[model samples]
Target: MKTLLHAAGLAAWLAMSQASAGISLNGTRVIFDGAHPEASVTVRNHGADILVQSWLEALDSDKAELPFAITPPLTRLPAGQEQLLRILYAGAGASDQQETAFWLNVQEIPQAAGKGNVLQLAVRQRVKVFYRPPGLDGDALQAPERLRWRLRRERGNSWLQADNPSRYHVTVTGLTLLSGGKSKEISRAQMLAPGAGGQWPLPADTANDARLRYQIINDFGASQAFEARLQGVAPAQPQRLEP
Candidate 1:
């Protein structure tokens, strides 16, 4: 078991690092190949000697029990030193046609402060681990562009509908609607599972002939942009944006 420890949001890394006591992770996210026996991640300590802990948790409590195990969950990491964390999955019958995600947690437990009134904070880094079954259809990296999009109106409110027909999961980072020289940003951080769909609210005054520009989180943990023209699109039908 081995790969990157993918953080859910990069901003979280910045917020936590301000404390000046933390560990550095090697990757933005983890991709666990189903056919492989294990995945690995590199964890490095930047401060004084401390005890580090690593574990995995199910993304959804309603889902099946996590069949993954992380070795050496507890270890002592010296200052300026790093260790390789290994992950082993039991292949818990995850969907053969789609990818499943989990939370990979690595926490820092610093040695007790010697002085009185000293505060010791244990900072933990949480990232996503995508378990991709072997031989799935389509390209995972291109799934975001392949999504079907449409703008809909309901009860005086406009909504943007996104339908992902691909076999991989896609995480959206940003969405903006541009029409008639007006641009409106929509707040939505979401992950679309294969063949699943979601909707986001749009400005009530959105133009009929609008242009939609959005960004999706790529495998490398960066935002990739896509643009689409939304004019004369039927409310009930999904359409792919112009290439």
Candidate 2:
């Protein structure tokens, strides 16, 4: 446990120093290997002594319970110090159909010093945690690029479907439809795992042959753009990739 803790701190410190100023995470995302008992995350405290709290919550509460726990849920993080946190999956069982996505919330609480109406706000950081079962096929890094986009209709209702065929999770950060020289951005933020899919209701007047341009959240917590056309139409080629 101690070694795991040490490793967690190192990872957090390396990943978050410049981008996150006061507190940084070791990695952009947490991948929990189901064959193992737990995963590790490091939190580095670059500011003054503060209290840090963390927890895990499931995205689809209706499907399964949030079965993960973060050790040392709340602790005093001394200035210039770092600590490794453990995420243990204690749920009934891992999802067999697809990778389960959860949210890891880490909040930093700073003391309030009354100095002329000072505002001492607590800064909370949230990151995606993907629970991957053993024996899942395909590479996670390629999952985003492998996603299939299509326009579907059922009972006179049209919707945009994004199917994930890879054995990894794809986090869609932004989506838009293009048709008749008109572009409409769809508001959606969800992760689709291997063998799973997501559908967004399209506007009643949306073009049936509209193309889709979406952004996937990469491992670094950054968005990467990609384009695809409806299933029956010719594929929409990508323009330029975001660096």
Best by lDDT: 1
lDDT for predicted candidate 2 compared with the true structure = 0.77
Kindly list the per-residue Cα lDDT of model 2 for residues 23-107, writing each as its tens digit: 7789888888888888999999988888898887776556656767899899899999998999998756767555878889888
**Model 1 Cα lDDT, one tens digit per residue, 1-243:** 122334444446656655577598998899988889888899998888999999988888677668788988999999999989998977665778888889899999989888788546788998999988888888887787778778888788988888888888888757888888988888778888889988888777877887777778888887777777776344332233443
Error of 2 at 212 (Å): 1.8
TM-score, one value per model? 0.85, 0.73
Which regions in candidate 1 have their CA more than 4 angstroms from the true location? 1-19, 232-243
Task: State the TM-score for model 1.
Answer: 0.85
The reply for model 2, stretches above 4 Å from the true place, is 1-22, 61-65, 112-119, 154-157, 231-243
**What TM-score does structure 2 among the candidates reach?**
0.73
